[model samples]
Each structure stands twice: as structure tokens, then as C-alpha cells.
Target chain A: MSSKSNDKDLGVRKIIYDKDGKPCRSCNTLQDFQFATGKISAKDIQHIKNGTEIAAASPQETILNSKAYRRVDPPGVEELGRSSWNLLHSITAKYPKSPSDEQKLEMKQFLTIFSHVYPCNWCASDFEKFIKVKAPKLNSREEFGRWMCEAHNEVNAKLKKEQFNCDFWEKRWKDGWED
Target chain B: MSSKSNDKDLGVRKIIYDKDGKPCRSCNTLQDFQFATGKISAKDIQHIKNGTEIAAASPQETILNSKAYRRVDPPGVEELGRSSWNLLHSITAKYPKSPSDEQKLEMKQFLTIFSHVYPCNWCASDFEKFIKVKAPKLNSREEFGRWMCEAHNEVNAKLKKEQFNCDFWEKRWKDGWED
Candidate 1:
């Protein structure tokens, strides 16, 4: 009798693998194991702590915009942490209520940095090189620092001239952002 | 005066209506639309086409498995037509290559449709209750048909097993699915 024909009799949704098939990738016990997502065959279930269970006991304050340098090309950053904040910053920065060409260029530059923070165009300097290239004419670093400081002011000046609702812009600027 | 010193002299890249001097979405335009691989303004470019253009004098045969489609949510069938032909059937079907569950599902269903000349699921059916479900299932109709046929065969005959190579499978089983 085929194992497929006896699916109801086996008391499972479906047998993940054929009987007497490949050995387990995880635990040495090749007989019993649950399949995980990503379609990888495994012989053991790795214990991952789900936050819901811990939430009731500890009520810990969640960290916002936390960085995990350990993770490279990590999945679910938007669902798990600061990706939502970053996305909002980008949308607002790029598509401000109203924008001018200069402002757009600034937004575009920042977006480039945000998307890909690679090594410098000249040698191997990091994001610092990006900041310098974006605002090149400055003789001193102090002026660049001032520009970063009043970056919001420049955005606001463009927005005011475009004639968008001031109250809305002020509220968003003051209240911060949610997903 | 320099364009920076006097905004009116800035030409196309000049700021038009700037309020808070923030990133303006409306007024910004791509500065290097003339160059390849540079920023192209969203507003300027139009009429993108994907597919080979043959001369009227002599029509050339299309390369096997060359199709193009846009990417979107619940992705359109037209979008996967090229991928279905090229990558799915041409490559994987020949070798019995193991693909992800999603890819497997796509190929299996595509095979059924590629062989069938009729698009509708049912040729003969009771009509009284068909008023509510006017259209036959679009996504999984072919899968359902094959499953039904296989189930019927299993119930009637004790066994039907066949082993064949990729060339035989492509030539005999798949209709109009060849170079």
C-alpha cells in the first residue's frame, strides 16, 4: 500500500517525506522530526523563545531602533524592530509634503546611503565619505555638522514655500512616527 | 551671481516652491536623464516595452522560453508566462530538479494548462447550482483535474506505473511545449 493512499489512516495532515527516505539533518535520530519553513529537512526542532510567553512574566520595555551588528542580511527586521521607523524617515525625507529640487537631491542622497552604506568612492572610508561627497564645497567639517543639525529646517523651508498644511507637518515633526 | 546664490538663475535644478526647505517630492527632477544608469525623473519618461521587435520584411522565430512580465502583489499570470516557459518547464521539468514547494506547485499546474486546449474546467456539468459559482477555479483547476483523474485510476485499476526520461516526458506528455 502506498503511504500517500494511507494519509488519513496515519493521523497527520501529510507525511513530509517518503518512508525510508533521507536521514535527518539535525538530530542523529532519523525517525522523528518536524519540518520547518525554508523547506530544509531537519531531524530536531531548535528551541526559539517566543516573545508572547515571556511578555506576561516580565513586561520589559521594548528597545526602539536597536542595532544588532551580529545579524547580516537578517530577515523580518521590519516586523521585529526599527525597519518601520527607518521606512517612515525615508518616505518623509524623500516625499516631503512638498519639495524643491535641492531638497529632493538631499533626500535622494540620504536614500542612497540608507539603502546601501558601502565603502567610500575614493578609497575605503564608510558613511563619513558619503556625508562629505553630499556636501562637498565646505572647507571645514563644522559647516557640514551645521547642515546635518538644521537638515529639518531646510526641509521645512521648502515645505512652507510649497504651501502644504503647516499644522500637519509640525505635528509629524513633533510627534515622531509610528509604523 | 552663482545659481546657488540666486535661486532664479538655477535653471531646471532650481527650487521653485520651497517652504520649510525640507525634501520636496513635487519639484525634484532627475538631473542626468540623458545618461544611462543615472537617475531618470519619474515624470519625464514614459512607454516602456518588453519583448523582441522583428522586422516586417522577414519574421524571425522567437527564442524558446523568452517572455517578460511586471512584478506585483498576487502576481499577474501574464507576469509569470516567460518564467513559466523558460525557467520552470525548460530547465526543471527535464531533470526532475527539486524546487521549493511554491515552485513545484507552479510548475505542476502550469504543465496541466500547457497541455490543455480548453481553458474551462468542466465540459459537462449540472447547471442548476452553477449560477453562484459562475467561473471555474482559475488558479488550481488543472491540478484538481489531474488529481481527480489519478484518484479515479487508483480506485479502478490496481496499479499504473511508468518511468520515462525528460525527452520522452516533454515530447509525449506536454503538447506544443518544445523548441
Candidate 2:
């Protein structure tokens, strides 16, 4: 095999193809992979077919080589999940102990809008379903905290991760554990 | 100094007190420091006061001792910022080039609610002011992307970080660089 073909073994391109041999762009992790190598640039495609190894660098490696690479790269689903959870739990921790009616309404509205706009399409859809089934409890801080903890546990279950101890919700997020 | 008092020198407790000597829970990094040593449990408080260094251990250390410590801890502000940026940019990258009117409305509503409910109180309030002055442009993907980049640059300027090149927004977020 040519060095260009050998580059596929490096686990860079996992291009899934349909029966007609067309690349399924959605199946690719790096969205622009097709555009980077597709018909727009026949010369580049020819370079690849000519067995040139230079055309085989992974999208990530190509990005890393860019001068602006140090600025910041877009976060994947996992990173988004972690950051979102941190923001959510912190908000719960700071929630008022005896919230007013208006405060409760605002909190509920916030959650509704959050579900609608959450960047991850699949995750957001799942969360919308979850919240619709079991609406958020915004009565008091303790109730809200526990409700949020259980919601998180639901996500953990879906992700096949271990469920957190809900009893220690405050201890973990708000108050530190008593050693 | 006794071991209990010595715990103070360990920099374990970074408590902030108000004018009345009451611990300002909001000002403290780790909550429950006062509660762990306060009068609610004289036995626990006395245990701390009686030169028992073990009783004075912070929750962070206690968590670090746990097996799940490596799994995840609450993200700090910087980590949260990085992850949030990632999610926002990725969403922008995936946004429809010629979005429907309904899509534009949803995006605007999402931003409004997001600004209000952003976990960081100060950051959220600041963002609220920002959106009010410079409303989100949802006419096209390019307009939205450039607007988002400029908003991020505003934040970067405030944080004294280098501004990103908006011209390369698509290249950095949607497409891999041309090597």
C-alpha cells in the first residue's frame, strides 16, 4: 500500500460511506473533513490519489499546526456537559433558601429556556423530555437542590455512569463535607 | 500553637468575616467551614478546638482522599469559561447559514434567558448589559458568528487576554486549517 493509504491506519479518518460510496458527513467527528478534501479542490483530491502522505494529516493535527491554534478550540460534547453541570450545580447552591413566588417563576422559566437553547442537540432534546416528564421543583433551596441532584442522576444513568449520593447534595456542592 | 490553632496556619480556612464578626458565607471559597466548627455541634466544635488537627481538615482534602476525586471536581472559573466558549462557538459553527425566522427567534430568546440565568452572577449581569446595548444579530450565520466573536473579544479585552481574529471564525470553528 502507498504511504497515503497507510495514513488511514493512523485512525484519523473514520469516513463512513453510504451504499452509493458517498461520504456521510454527519458520521464524521470533524465536520469539515469532506469540505477539506472534497470536489471543491480537485488538485488536493488528486494529490491524495497520487499517494502523497502530506495530505493525510488528521484534522486535529492540521488545526494544531495553525498559528491561531493557541487561541482556543471548540469544546466537544463531554467538555460542554462538564461545564454545564458545574454552572447548574453552582446555581443550585446559590439558590435562595426561601424563594419568593416571582423568584420561583423566574427559575422555572430559566430552566425551560435553558432546555430549549442548550447547544448539544441530542443532549438538549433528551433534557427537554426529562424535564417535561418531571418538572423542576423550585419551592425552596433544599427541594430545588435535591431535584437538581436527581435530575443529574438521571443523566448519569443514561450515560451509564455511577449515580451520585443525593443525600450529600449540599455537602458536595454547597457545604463542604464534614471530615 | 496547639495543633487545632495550627490548623489556621495551614491556610486551610480562608474565612472572610463581616463587620459584626459573622462569617460572610458568600465571600468564602469553601462553604461549611464555619458550620464544621460552629456551635451546632459542640462535640464537633470542641473536637476542633481541643487541638485535634484531624477535625480541622478542609472538605477539599477529604474529597481528595476519596476514590472518586479523580473522576471530577467542580470546575473553577477559568475552566468554566473555556468550556462555555467551546460550546458557544461550536453552536455558532453548526448554525444554519440561512436560518428560518423561527430559528432566529429561538436563538434570540435563548440568549436572553441564558444571560439572566448564567451561573456566575456578575458575569450574567454584565452579559445582560452587553446584549441590551449590542443586540444579537440573527439575520444570517455570518452576522451571528461575527457578532459572537466581537462579544467574546469584549470579554477577552476585559480579562486582558489576546483578542481572536474574527476573520478566521469559520476556519477555527467549522473547518480545519489549510496546511
Candidate 3:
């Protein structure tokens, strides 16, 4: 077996077959995805609904309730922030462009990393309480971003004079810091 | 708000906690795992390392590669096959069993599922492929279970003929049968 590489370079490859392996629902074309050389990843028949074609009657194809999901590789520690950022941006999309998608994404990214070290349920009420009291309910992405920045300050204020762990901070702050 | 029902009847609640807010790893005291309903799910405070004491470590106390690992939930209608089964089982300790003890706990219950699903690779190939080809070794749980039962013929043989969705099977079987 080859030695595992770090997050920066996870070598991956694809498997090809004569007949299209998976067909897309819309055009009945093949679904495009990658596979690791020796590893197998999950595949989805593109655009299929609940074992049926998506009719206007079915608003959403299917909502997978399980918290578990699979991808090509085990998620990299560095990738967590980015994944969380995408999640936040998606959730913020529900509310009118209030919290700019970019800022909301940042807050979710930061919290994902924070939860790693802090060991708190991201959705736990106590944590939610901390946010609700310390930060107003974020109406927009900018407001959410401001809240997170403030939370960072609060943490540093307690460590007063002692700088926050730069390495830890850097890992979470994937995109360049605004301030 | 509805009071906590006896989930024990449902085979859902396995772990128990005493606190009303959240499980505090530091004190090993009972805490509410959920805030809205003040209900806690059954959980074991797994020392990222199974045998180590959480407190001995200075900065890293909780699960290593600390992240929220939501428990694997039951599969849905669409997730009934080999790929989804392997993906679902991979997350929980009940499915895969690791080859070595030194590997991460996540590796523990996964060996079985891994062996089975490794060859299938997103359902591209099933266990029957390995059996017929007499190549590509299979030994893990996934191999034994998924490949042997569902992928092979064990599952099909065991199922009552009535359980077979003849219409579905007829539609998918050899090209001539479908036409």
C-alpha cells in the first residue's frame, strides 16, 4: 500500500467502463465523478427521484435524514472549514440577501473549527445561548460575520495580552482575514 | 413542550445521562445533549483513544481529530442497496472492524464493511464479480456481508420469493427479459 499523503495532496483516480456506469436523469447521459485508484466511492443515478422520475408532484426528490454522508476520501482536517463555509452559505441563501453569503459562510467555517477544539455541540442551546446573548440574531451575512469577529475578540480579551493560538486560528480562517 | 417519552421502548435510547443541559466531558456529569427539548441521546464519552483518561491531556481532551460525528441513522428507501449500506455502516462502530488496534477507533467496526464494499466501489462491481473472477481478495465485513449476501446470492436466496420485486427484477434483468 502506498504511504498516505497529507491533506494538500490526496492522490485520486477514476475507473472507467465500456457502458456508461451511471446515467443522468435529465438527459440520460453518464454521471461524471472521480474514484480513488484502489478505493471505491458512492455513486448516485443523476436526477432520479424517490426511485422514480421527478414529477412536479414531488417537490423535492428525497430528503436523506441521516447525518452521515460519504465522499471520495475521508474529509481532511483542513477541508472542514471549507465544507462548513459552503453549508453556511447554503443556509443563508434561504433568507433574502441580508447576511451576505460570504460572511455567513465565514462564521460557519469558524464555528466548525471552534467546535473541533471546544467540544461543544454546534447546535446545543448553551452554545446557541452564547451566540444569542453575545451576538444578535444574524439577519444578514455581514451581521453574522461581525458577530464571529466579536466572539474572537471576547476569547482573546480573556487571554488578555496572551495572543490567541495563531496555528489554531489560521487553520479555521481558510479565507484571508478581513481585519 | 412535550415531556420526554420513554424511548427505551423504541430501542433508541441506549446511553443515559443525568444533567439537564449537555454532557460535560470534564466532570463526567450528566448534561442535556439537546437544548430545545432538554433531551439527551445515549452517548459514550469515547476518549478519542479508547483507554486514555480525557483529563490527563492539557489542551486536547475530547475526541481526537475532534469533530461532530453524528451517529449513523437508519437507511431510507433509496439507500437500501450495497453502496448506501456500506456508507451508512462505515460511520457506526457496529459495522466495520479494523485490522489493527493502533489505527483510529473509526477503523475498528469498519474492517468488515470495508472489505465488502472495497471491491464494489460505488456499486460498480459486486461480490459475485470477485467470486467469479477468482481475483481481488475479499475478507472484511462488507465483503462477507454485502458481497456475499446482497451482492452475491445469499440475500436473494434467503428472501422469500414473494419478497422479490419481480416487476423490478424483470425490468432490470438481461436485456432480452426487459424488452
lDDT of each: 0.27, 0.62, 0.29
Better of 1 and 2 by DockQ: 2
User: What's chain A's TM-score in each predicted model?
Assistant: 0.23, 0.64, 0.26
Q: Individual DockQ of the candidates?
A: 0.01, 0.22, 0.02
On DockQ, the candidate that comes out on top is 2
Per-residue error (Å), model 3, residue A171 = 14
Q: lDDT per residue, candidate 1, B1-179, as tens digits?
A: 11234323322333322254432222232221111112222232221122333222112332223232111111111222212222222222122223445544544433332222111112112121231243222234243323333332332243233322222323222221222
- How does candidate 2 fare on TM-score? 0.64
Which regions in candidate 1 have their CA more than 4 angstroms from the true location? A1-82, A93-95, A118-179, B1-179
lDDT of 1 by residue, A1-179 (tens): 12345334323223333122632111111112222121212212221112222112112232223231111111111111122222222234223344455544544444333223111111113334444555522222233323333443343354352322323332222221211
Give model 1's TM-score versus the native structure. Answer: 0.16
Q: What's the distance in Å from true for residue A36, model 1?
A: 13
Determine which window of 10 residues in candidate 2 chain A has minimal summed lDDT: A1-10
Residue-by-residue lDDT tens digits, candidate 3, A1-179: 12224311322212222223331111111122122222112222222322444323112222233132211222221232223333232222222335455544444443432232221122222445565576543566344434444554454454363333323332222111212
Off by over 4 Å in 2: A1-72, A177-179, B1-73, B176-178
lDDT of 2 by residue, B4-95 (tens): 34445444344444344554333333323344346234344455556654443343443333444322334434555665666567667656
1 against 3, candidate with superior DockQ: 3
Each model's Cα RMSD: 26.6, 10.4, 21.3
Assign candidate 2 its CAPRI class: incorrect
Q: Model 2 over residues A67-166: C-alpha lDDT tens digits?
A: 4444333454566677677767767876788888877887887787667656565677788998899999998889998999999999988877867777
lDDT of 1 at B178: 20
Alpha-carbon runs more than 4 Å astray in model 3: A1-30, A33-179, B1-84, B88-179
